[model samples]
Target: MINKIRLAIRNDLEASAETRQFGSGWISGFLALVASIAGLLLLLSQRYPQWFSMKELALIHNQTIFSFVIQSILVIAFLLALINLVLRRNKILGFSAITLVFASLLIGQLIDPQEQYIANAYALGFDWFVLNLLLTGLLFIPLEKLFGRLTDQPLFRSEWREDLFYFLISSVLVQIISFLSLSPSMFILETTGSWSGFRLLVAEQPLVLQVLEIMLLTDFVQYWFHRLFHEIPFLWRFHAVHHSAQKMDWLAGSRMHIVEIVGLRGLTIIPMFVLGFNQQALSIYILLVYLNATFVHANLRFNVEWLKPFIVTPRFHHWHHGIEKEAINVNYSIHFPWLDKLFGTYYMPPHQWPKGYGIGGHPVPNGYWKQFLYPFQKKKKTK
Candidate 1:
């Protein structure tokens, strides 16, 4: 049954978007599948909070509103699936979605919201995954459809599953990633306890000023690290996985090597952590980073030439992923385009996008696990 569901999705993904007409039931069926899966995942997290829920997200899901949301989603999924079954000759998507919704309903009966268990050494971040997916997908999907740079590009573009998998693992392992990324900063703070007076002074500054300072500091650190990954051969092996994306979309940025993720977070966050930015400032900065990262990588068609000199835009970052010869080793800054201009690495052709994306020869193999092990594998010689 599981294999059947997987095959159904794979088939749908491979199907041409042109064939999936409005009244043909494909859209409703696909949405039904998503709703069912999301509903089930949230229900599982509620049932086994210790293993599937993040402690930080407790407040977000604890309210009665969340319960109402889950119920509404399940109901919507069931109705959509029924509509698909009535309209389409293929029953696969409809049947599969309905089955999952039924499974979620059965498990919902066993859930005890009051029951609590202490979290073990490790737990999945299901709550985080669901929320992240809902928020980003909701915001970007419609915008992309309406104003995408590549207007014809389908939602399930080539290699989308791989990027989505990257999104899944990164979110589900958020706890592990956060701990690994933040431990060094935590240690530095403890060891430099004498610097508390200085840190306190920095933290006492206006919240707006602190956030601006954080943006500059973190961008400066990330700029050099970003260049090093491109220049250093060993590091390029891992970073190449990110560049291997042939298509640019909101989800494409999620295709990063885990090693790079940890290293970047660990190194760039030192100033924010050790310098004692207040918790509120740090939180706001984190939120900004999340939104900015998504925005820069999104497939939007907005004209932002006015802001190009001061800030990074989709066209600016797309050049970094361009496979053209001149595109090599340029545009290393993430937030401030001026950093690249100052360091003489800036290259953005006025009113022009990349001819194509991905590595020149496409050395990096496809899929998540393959790319994960790619950096460790020895490269083959070609005469």
Candidate 2:
């Protein structure tokens, strides 16, 4: 049964809408599978909080709202799976979902009231992963569906599995990444203790002002850092993995090399951390950057021509991934388009997007592991 279910899923992943009709229960089955898996993961995280859950999210674990959420997800999964079982010819997806629902229930029954979690050096961000996935998916999926630039693009577009894997890896390892990314700034701050007065002055400013200052400073640092990745052959290899996406969507931006993620975060965050931005301001900036980055890479078509000059938009960043000759090495800033204009690398045609995305040759191989090690591989020499 397990083997059959696995094979069915593998085949379904490769099948398109043309092959699998819309009313053939596949959509319900897919949703059921997703909910079941999510429910199971949440159950495990609740059972083994020390290893599977984030300490920061501990307060919400036993909350009535959280428990209600888990129950609702499980109920929805069961109903969808049952509906699919009644409607679909193949029972793999439906049966698999039902089996998972039962498994989660079994785990839930074993939860102890006295369960205690010890402090540890490391923990999986499964809790964070679940929340991030839910929040981002709920917010962007609907927007993309209603107003997406590429209306015909399916939710499960080509290479979606690879991008989803990238998203999972980054979120699951958030703890390690945060620690390493911020370590450099923390070390520098500890050594250079004379900047307290300056830092205090910066921190005392209004929250709105601090956020704007953060945007300006970080964008400037990111502008050069992004350009360096394009110009340098070695760095270009790492950055090429990002541009290798043939389709543009919210998930596309997550397809970055871990090295680049660490390096970029470490460098760009130096100013924010060293300058001692208020924690509230830093939190706001972090949220803004998250939304802004996702928005720029989204497959949405908003005619915000007036705002393009002041802030970066989907059109501006799309050109960076454009495969056309004109799009090569342009639009490097994340928040502001003016930096690109100042540096003379900005390229945007009025009322135009790219013919297509990705490197001209599509040199980067598919899959997460291959792309991760691609930069280190020796290139072939043509005689």
Which residue pairs clash within candidate 1? none
Go through the candidates in order and give the C-alpha RMSD of each one to the true structure: 2.0, 2.4
lDDT (tens digit, per residue) of candidate 1 on 211-302? 99999999999999999988888888878888889999999999999999999999999999999899999999999999888888899986
Worst 10 residues of 2 by lDDT: 112-121
lDDT values, one for every candidate: 0.88, 0.86
Question: Largest TM-score belongs to which candidate?
Answer: 1
The estimated TM-scores of all candidates read: 0.95, 0.94
- Per candidate, the number of residue pairs that clash is 0, 0
Pick the lDDT winner. Answer: 1
TM-score of structure candidate 2 = 0.94
Candidate 1 has an lDDT of 0.88
